[model samples]
Target: MSKDYYKVLGVEKTATADEIKRAFLKLAHQYHPDKNGGKDDKFKEINEAYQVLGNAEKRKQFDQFGANFNGAGGFGGGQGYGGFGGFQNGGMNINMDDLGDLGEMFGGLGDIFGFGSARGGQGRRREPQRGSDIEAAMTIDFLEAVFGAEKEVTLKKKITCAHCGGTGAEPGAKIEECPTCKGHGRVRRVQQTILGSIQTEASCPSCGGEGKIASKKCSECNGAGTAYDTAKFKVRIPAGVDDGGRIRIPGYGEAGDRGAGVGDLYLNIRVRPSDKFARDEYDILTKKEISFTQAALGDKIEIETVHGKVELKIPEGTQSGTVFKLKNKGVPHTSGRNIGDHLIEVVVKTPKNLNKRQKESLKELGI
Candidate 1:
């Protein structure tokens, strides 16, 4: 039976040339043998269909003869349309136009497949690269972490060149196209594959992807597009941030090469412990000692909190390990929206070594 190229490429007979090309490209990307879940037979079948339908004259002849037409036009003298027996006898003929598109298709996927260089180990392009990220350790007092503070940090790293504005060109230098790639930023090479002779493209190794070079190098950065210097910036620490917390400062990291973006700076915060208070989440816990007289008679006493010293009422007959809450006396929220409470634990101190006269007076009152 004659093959239907239109059904093979999944396009209508009235489909335009661009539509047919798009369908072929899409299917080829899906069934490329190198990709996962791709079948070799399916890939060859799609390519064979495109070989006929992709050509105008062949498509017209196919439309006239219909799917059952196996005569002898494009399929090599009565070999029939459905017979791929030509595979054993070298039937992998690809069009030059499709070859260029295929090269472009593979060229854009260099990063994905890590296709560094071409055949014979050709050098790869110097692609634009980002700067390295920075991490710094910071130690702050407990109060500072609770209330937040701004601190200055100093770092020594590469910074953007002040001269020539990171273009790597001197005050008066001529910028010219890359000699290697001829300003195309990419170079094409032909290779023989299982699919037969094919052309593929890669980034220009000499000039990178910019395809441009400077005649004179910058004096300040020496053509590196960046310089080394000490930089200092203030970092804002938010409130209620616990120990082992992390703060991110964006774009403050090392500068990228060839005028790319900068990286980030991460601050690892370590909060010092307080002597008088302990913390649980956002709440502050403190222990206070009260005399037995004060606990029995119900007296007001000063208690220490993260916020400040506050008055706490000791209720009558209060026992040891009794807890009291002071609202809004703990840590403040990072957003300043709300505050936590301060938990106060009371410890009663019993009077000891009473006088004998005082003991006898208590016995007489009981008699």
Candidate 2:
């Protein structure tokens, strides 16, 4: 059956080589069997299309022949088979060497083919990766959050093994080349996929990509290079750190493999709710109940703030639910530039179940 390679890859005939490759990778990743809803037949079609249109000479010949561009039978070349191979078992077969500059495109696709550690598209070797960041939750009281406090956190984490000196070897151990990957630290593989035979590379598993093994393993840490132990570290809780705030401590997380960089420790701050106060940004909010007499006649009342107890004056005939502000009495700013104001909401207490004498006295005063 005749096939349009350009249409299969969703590219125009005038598409450049890079554009053709980009389109093929997109479609390939989209329809890969390992991915969800991946169609095997569609992936095969995309591979077939790219095998022809992705190459410069093959693309030129494909353009010339319009749809039937078999270099061996249709274009001459006999049983020599040209550079491309015939389809077998409903799969398009092609020479791996002919796919020039494909190392980058096929890199990291190793997982799909069960290939060893694959390099990135850039073909650069993977370096020692940093340890993962650790997350911990801390609960501080409202006052502590406002005033800031230094507290100790105990955790079990991995650290560089002192016995191994951050190395996997024991004291004065000889190093030898790995036999699995042949000292290359990575292994190459040719895998049969819906796209055809794909060439991929991956890090060696036996040596953990180090390409070397120690003659004597560290007895304290086993063969691994890190030690797992419990440690207590002091963490400063900064002021104005509201709930859900996070503080990062660098190089305080798990130690990296070998001698690589360590990870970070992140503390998630959770402020305890205050019985007498609520917070808004850096401000403190509180409610005070004022009696009917106090609301009718102006009076000074004591209100509890984040800083301390403060006096608030209620104006004469002050209505219920009136809000008052106390300057510089709230929590301090995280930036230390300014302090927030303390907001006091006044609520008038209505006297209920009054005595008969009190009710009669009120009636007489009104009359």
Off by over 4 Å in 2: 1-3, 12-22, 33-36, 56-81, 87-111, 115-135, 206-213, 243-251, 260-269, 280-283, 291-293, 299-302, 307-313, 325-341, 349-367
Clashing pairs in 2: 116-202, 117-201, 117-202, 117-203, 118-201, 118-202
For 181-240, candidate 2 gives per-residue lDDT tens digits of 778876666657555555555566556678887878788877566789897889888888
**How far does residue 293 in candidate 2 sit from its true spot (Å)?**
4.1
Candidate 1: segments with Cα more than 4 A from true spot: 1-112, 118-125, 162-165, 184-211, 219-222, 353-367
| TM-scores vs. true structure, each candidate | 0.65, 0.71
lDDT of 1 by residue, 38-110 (tens): 7788877777776667668667767887966552334674644533324333333334334445547655433
lDDT of each: 0.74, 0.75
Question: Residue 7 in model 1: shift from native, Å?
Answer: 16
Count of backbone collisions within predicted model 2: 6
> Which is the leading candidate under lDDT?
2
